[model samples]
Target: MVAPSPYQIVKKLKVSRVLVFRTAQRYRRLGTSDDMQRRGRPVTVTTPEAVKAVREKIRRNPARSMRKMAKEYKMSQGSIRTIVKDKLKMIPYHGSHLTTLFIDEKIFTVEANKNGQNDRIIATDYQSACEKGKILNKTSHPASVMVFAGITADGKTPLIFVDPGVKGVALGQFSLRKPIMDLPARRRPRSSRQRDSRVVSRQFSEFISAVDWPASSPDLNPMDYAVWIYLTEKVSSKNYPSIKALKTALIKKWDEIDDDHLRAVIDAYPKRLKAAIKAKGGRFENYS
Candidate 1:
C-alpha cells in the first residue's frame, strides 16, 4: 500500500505539518518511522553513578561553577554540563545585577512563600510620574506625580495619589488596613517593600506587617513587572495636559485591568521561583 502524504497524516493525527512530513519521508526511505541508528562511539563517562554524583554536588552547593564541578568530578566540562542538563534536568542560573546577598534573600522569600508560611504576598511600589510634551528649552523639569499602588493575587488596589513634595508621609495617610483585613486570617497576607521608608517604619510598624524586599530585585515584584509596566505604557501612549489628567488616566487604566490577567500574574510566582533556581539565583529574562 502507498503511504499517505504528509498533509493527509497531519489531518488524521492533528500533529504539526513539519513533524508529519519528516516522519513520512523517513518511512518512505527507511521503511520505518524510527530513526536510523547512526554509527558513533558510545558515551561512557555519563554513567548512572556520575549523574548521581553531579546531582548530589548540585544539591549540596548550587552555586558551584560548572568548571569547578568538572574538575571535582574528573570529567570534561562539556560532559558535566550534559549530565547536569540532560540527565539531571538542572539549569545554571546567575542572579540579576543584585549582589549575592540580595539574591539569597529573594530565594528565601520565594521558598517561604512556596511552603505556605506566608500565604498571601502583595507587591507595592511607587512610579515616578512624568509629563508628556515638547521640551522647548533646557533646564526645565517636567511636572510629575508620585503614584503609589499595590497588587495581590486577586487584583490591584485603587491608585493612591501622593501629594506633591510629600514623601514617606503619604503612606502614613493612605490606609492599608482595609486591604489586609479583606484577606482571610488563615492566609496571613504580607506586603513587601524595598526600603523602610518613614511611613513603612513608623506607620506600618503600628498596624501593617511587611517583608523586607530586595531593593534591586524588581523582577520579584508583580507591581514592577506586571501592573506598573502595563499602566505606564498605557498612560504614556496618550498626552495629558496636566498632572490631574495623568492621575485620571492612571486610575482608569488601573481599573481596566481585569481579574483574569491579575490572577495569571500572581499564579506565575511558582514559575518565577523555578526560573530563579534554574538560573542559579540569577536574573531571569522570561517568567512565562
Candidate 2:
C-alpha cells in the first residue's frame, strides 16, 4: 500500500502525540483526584519516618502486597504502593519470579526485545522446575487450582491465581515456599506473563492448549472475569452456614451458568481485545 500524504502523516502523528499526553494527564488526574483521600480528617502518616517504614517493608519483601502492609501497619495501601514504586523502586512480584528457580540457565532466556540480548535473563533463575514436575496428570483435582482464594464483590470463590495452566504458569509463592496471597473484592492486582515450560517436562504437555493462551491477554477468560461478578453477588448478601457451604455454593453457581450469559461475555471479548491493542499491550483490569 502506498504511504499516506505527508500532511496526513503529520496529522496522524499529531493525534498520536495528543493521545499519549491525554492518557498521561488522565492518570495524573486520577492520582491527584479525591476518590481515595477521604472527604474529611487530616492525614496522619505523611511523616518521613512512616514513609521510610513503607519503603523498608517493600524492599525486604518485594512480593508483600501494598494492601497487606496497609492493614498490618495501619496505613493506606495505595499510598504505600505509590511511594514504593516512585521512591524505593521495586516491581510488585511477577509470575516469572514465582518458581523455586529456573530449571536451566544454560539456554532459556526471558521474554525480551526482538534484538535478543543476554541481559533479558533474570540472573539467578535461568532454569527451574515446579518441585520436580509433579502436576503431570490431566485429571489433577485442582485441574484448575486457582492459586489465590478469597471473597470477591459477590461471593467467596477461589481467586483465579494462575490460569491457562501452561508454561510460565507457575503459582507465585508469597514466601520462600509458601502459597500466594488472596485479596478481597475491593482490590485488583497487576499480573505478569509466564514463560514456557522446559521440554524435559513434556509429560504435562498433554493438557496444555494454545487456545487457552489467547493472544497475550488477561482479558480473554470468561470464568476469570464475568463469572467473578456473579460469584461476588451470590455470596456477599447471605451468610454462609459453614466453609463447606461456601464451597458448595461456588461449585453450583459455576455450573448453573447457561449459554446465553456466556455468549454476552463472548461478545464483549472483542472490546477488551481492542482496548488491549489500543493500550499497546498494557493490562486492562477487569475490576477497573
Candidate 3:
C-alpha cells in the first residue's frame, strides 16, 4: 500500500499542525515515527522503591490523598498520582467527605431473576445456552434470602441478612449504626408497599401522613435506580443451588466493590434529581 502524504495524514487524522510536523521530523531522522528515547534526566522518583512505599501507604489508608503523600515523600503530586494509578492500578476514590448514607433491601432467590433481556443467552449458531438447559425457569416459590445494606461516598456497610419472615418492628433490633455521621435514606420496596407498611405506619403514622412522598419515584432513590440493579446483574448471572450459596456470592461481590464506584453513584444523585424535576417526578428513568 502507498503511504499517505503528510498533508493526507493530517487531513485524515485531523491532528494538530505541531504534532504532524514533529512526526514528520522524527520519521525523516529515524525512518519511523514511533517512540524513541530522548536525552533527559532518568525518572528516579517513581522507582520500584517509591512504588512499594506508595502501595504500602495506600494499603494502610486507602483514603490518603496524593497531595498528602507527595508532601510526606518530598515528591510532586503528579509523581505520586502516577505511582498510585499507573504503577499500582488503583483508583483515587474521594474520602468520607459526604455524609448521606443510602440504604436498601433486596431479596435473592435460588432462581435468578430472568426477565426479558436478562433471559438471553450466548451460544453457538442455532445452539444457545437455553437449548443446553442453561437457563433457569421461574418458580412460584423459591428459597430466598433478603439482604439489607447501606452505602455512602466512602464505602458500604456489611451485608445484613434478614431472618426469614422478619417483620418491620423486629428490623429495628438489627442496630443499623455506623461510626460515620449519616443522613440515612432507606428505600424498602417490598416492606414499603406490601408487608411492613401497616407495622411501619403504626410506629411512625404522623411522619407517614405528614410527608407527601412521591408514590412511584424509583429514580429518586439511588439504591432503587442503580445499586440494586447492579447487584442483581452481578449476582444473578447464574442460578444458585441454594440460598446459602447465593448469600456467600453476594457477600463476596459486595465487598469487592470499590469506593470509587460508590462515590460515583453518590455524585450522580444531583443529576438524577435534576432529571426527576424535569420530568415532574414521573417516569424520570428515561429522562437521561
Candidate 4:
C-alpha cells in the first residue's frame, strides 16, 4: 500500500505536520508510537497530598530541613526536596529582607580589621607575619564593642551601642527601647537569635512571621552583604588605639553614608532573590 501524504496524516490524525513527522520518526526508530520506558526509578513520593503536607510544614518553618521532614513524613530527603522545589515552588532563602528596616549587629575591634584587602602587605620572606603594626597580643583579646543598627532605603537608624556581655533577653529590651518604625519588624541574625528566648520571643510577637524571618541569612540583607562591608572597609582603613576611637569613626562614617548608596543597595535586593532562586536555596554568591 502507498504511504499517506502529510496532508492526509494531518487531516486524519488531527495533529500538525510537525507532530505527525515526529511521531512517524519515533515509530520508525523505536518500532512503536507509544512513549518508551524511561530509565531510572519512577517518581513515587511527590504526590499532591505529600506536596500539601510539605507546604504546611514549610509554612510553619521556612528553614525546616528536608532531612527532618523526610524523617517526619517517612519519605526520602530527595522526595521531600522535590516536593519543595518542583511542586511547591519554594526557595530556601538564607533570610528574608523584605522589611521596613534591615537590622543587624557587628562587633568592631580596636585593632585593624584584617580582611583580604587590608591583610596583604609587601614583605620579604624573612619578615615576621606579626611585625610592629601587624602584631597581635597573644594573652589578651582586642577591645571590641558591639553595635546594632537598622537601615532603610532612604536613611539609617542611629548606631545603638550594645553593652558588653549582654544576654539575649537584655539585648532585645535594650536594642528595641524605642520603636523605630510603625510598620511590622523584620530583623537579621541578632534579632533572629534573640527570638529563641521566651522573653525575647514575646517582645517579637508583634513582629513578622518567624517562618519568613529565620536566622543565619546575611546574604539577603543589604546590611550584611553590602552596607556592613562598606562600613568595615572605612572603619578598618586605619587602626584605632581604643574602642572609643572606633566608635567615633563608625558614627561619623555612618552619618556620612550617601542616601543614594542606600537606595541602590535596597534596589538590588530583588535581583538577589532571583539569584537565590537560581541557586535552588544554596550559596548564590558566585551567581549574584
> Who wins the TM-score comparison?
3
Q: Backbone clashes in each candidate structure, one number apiece?
A: 7, 12, 0, 0
Error of 1 at 151 (Å): 1.6
Q: Model 3, range 24-116, lDDT digits (tens) per residue? A: 898888999896786899878999999999899988988888899999999999999899889899888654343666667788887867765
Query: Higher-TM-score candidate among 1 and 2?
Result: 1
Q: In model 4, how many backbone clashes occur?
A: 0
Q: Name the runs in model 1 displaced over 4 angstroms.
A: 1-140, 169-174, 178-218
lDDT of 2 at 70: 79
Predicted structure 3: lDDT: 0.74
Candidate 4: give the clashing pairs.
none
Model 2 Cα lDDT, one tens digit per residue, 174-245 = 221221224332322333223344442464756556655447656444445665546555543333445455
Worst 10 residues of 2 by lDDT: 103-112
Q: In order, what lDDT does every prediction score?
A: 0.61, 0.47, 0.74, 0.74
- Candidate 1 per-residue C-alpha lDDT over 116-199 given as tens digits, one digit per residue, 9 for 90 to 100: 243333334222211221212222355666666565555455566655565454353343445444545433244434344554
User: In model 1, which range of ten residues has the least summed lDDT?
Assistant: 103-112
Per-model TM-score on C-alpha atoms: 0.41, 0.26, 0.52, 0.49
